[model samples]
Target chain A: MEFSYEVKDSYAEVKADGRLNMVSAPKLREFVTDVIAGGSSRIVVNLENTAFMDSSGLGALIGCLKAARQAGGDLRIAAVQPQVKMVLELTSMDRVLNAYASADEAFGND
Target chain B: MTEVLAERSFRGLAEAEAIESVHDELDGLWNDAPFVEAMDQMTFTTAVIESASNIVQHALPAEAQRPVELGVDISVRSTLLQARVSAFYAKPPLGQLEPGTPDEDSESGRGLALIEALVTTVTFERQDGTNIWILSKSPQA
Candidate 1:
């Protein structure tokens, strides 16, 4: 998967533009951690183009969330595709990660 | 017996790269058999990848000289989708085979549960020295 980030006013938007599987999970964790360390703890992972994600990918997201919170901020996912959405709901993690319709809306209310 | 309309298989070193190749094969299988509904395709692909990923991540070499090999055989029948995900030259699976209810914050133990939720049935078999996960899902009408 390809990862790119932009620091928005309230959060850093990380765009993951491919399959988030075992191969790319660690890369995502590393990329997000760097973003956190770069002084933007609040993160929004844009999954608009991420077509597939397995358990490994989900684990990375959870790890990233913990890291963001530890840095005194938060993390959210936006524009989840159907397959990713199914995995999230089935694992009952939808309650924790919480999906928004768009990146702009992720930190909009906060 | 249901006749298979289309089939695909891959066998290689049980590593991270194998997961992508298996996924590519699944995508090709879908292209060959377009009659399967979108939901079935999505769910089945997830289950297959989950099973294959488990083998790559957890399966250990049963012997010192040989490493584990991953094998995936997926077939599309009239109304059923089936895949046998195998780990060759591997030891028996460790821990309980049943799915655990992890807390919302936990990340690692959700794979088996997700596989069960995605398919109609999941069965595990260990024959000779290979561990196999058989997953089947009936297409939606």
Candidate 2:
């Protein structure tokens, strides 16, 4: 998996492409944590290209969400593919992650 | 006897990288058997990867100085998909095999329940120091 971020006006948009499995879960958490530490608490993880995700990957996302909230901000995901959406719903994490239609909409109206 | 239309097998050291390799194998397996329904393929792949990931994360070596190896055998039949995910050279799992209902805030402990929900049936067995999880799913008609 590969991670890149752009600090938008209201939030940092992190694009994660490729499989979000156990192999890359920790890296994701670290990447998002660094983004939050860099002072952008409101985050939007773009998963448009993330084709796959396991429980480990879901856990990493939850961890990142908590980190953002602790920093007085928020984290949301957008463009979730079918497989990721299935995992989130099955594990009941979808209610907490709060998926949006796009990165722009994630922090929109906030 | 069941006729397997497509199958994939992988065995390697139970490490983080092995998960990716197994996932690659699953992707190939789907290519080999595109006749399988999309939902069946999706659900079965998730269950297999979850089982394999559990081994890598928790399975311990049965003997000192020996590393645990992950083994996966997945097959697609006319109407069913199955996977045997194993932990080679591993000791018996210590905790409950049952899935837990973790609160929404928890990050882990959801893999087991997710697997149960995805597949039709899940069973475990131990033989010759290897622990195996059998996950099977019946394709939608």
Candidate 3:
């Protein structure tokens, strides 16, 4: 998986493209941590290209969410594909992660 | 005897890379059996990868001389998808096999529960120093 970020006016948009599996989960955590350290706590992880995710990946997202909140901001996901959506719902994390239809809509009202 | 419409097998060192390889095998299997519903393919793939990832992350070597090897055998039949995910040269699992209801903020402990929800049945067996998890899901009509 590859992670890249763009600093929008209110938050950072982190684009993660590829399978979010055990192999790539830790990297995602580290990448998002770096983004937070770079002065953006409000985050939007674009999962449009992330086709698959396992438990480890879910854990990583939860960890990222907590990190964002600790910095007094928030982390939300947008453009979740089918497989990732299934994992989130099955694990009851869809309620926690809070998916939006698109990146622009993630922090639109906030 | 059950006729297998398609099958795929993989054996390798139980580690991070094997997960990707197994996932690739699963993608190819789907290509071979395109008649399986998208939902079935998606759920079964996730369940198999979860079981394999569990072995890579947690399975312990049974002896000093040999490291654990992950072995996966997946087959698609007329109306079913089955996978035998194994950890060779591994000791008996250390913790409970049952799923836990972790706190929402918890980062782990959800794999087993997710697997159970995705598949029709899940069973475990340990024999000859190999621990195997059998997962079967019936494709939707």
lDDT at residue B31 of model 1 (Cα atoms) = 100
**Can you tell me which runs of candidate 3 are displaced by over 4 Å?**
none
Global Cα RMSD, each model: 0.7, 0.7, 0.6
For each candidate, the DockQ is 0.93, 0.88, 0.94
Model 2 reaches an interface RMSD of: 0.7
Question: Chain B of candidate 3 versus the native chain B: what TM-score?
Answer: 0.98
Write the residue-wise lDDT of candidate 1 on B18-128 in tens digits: 999999999999999999999899999999999999999999999989999999999999878999999999999986889888888887999999999999999999999
lDDT of 2 by residue, B1-141 (tens): 479889999999999999999999999999999988888888889999999999999999998899999999998898778899999999999988999998887889999999999999999999999999999888899
Isolated chain B TM-score per model: 0.98, 0.98, 0.98
- Kindly indicate the candidate among 2 and 3 with the higher lDDT: 3
- The TM-scores, chain A only, for the candidates as listed are 0.99, 0.98, 0.99
Please give, for residues A1-110, the per-residue lDDT of candidate 3 as tens digits: 99999999998999999999999999999999999999999999999999999999999999999999999999999999999999988988999999999999999999
Once superposed on the true structure, which residue ranges of model 1 sit more than 4 Å away at CA? none
For candidate 3, what is the TM-score? 0.99
Which of candidates 2 and 3 is the stronger one according to DockQ? Answer: 3
Which candidate should be chosen as best, given DockQ against the real structure? Answer: 3
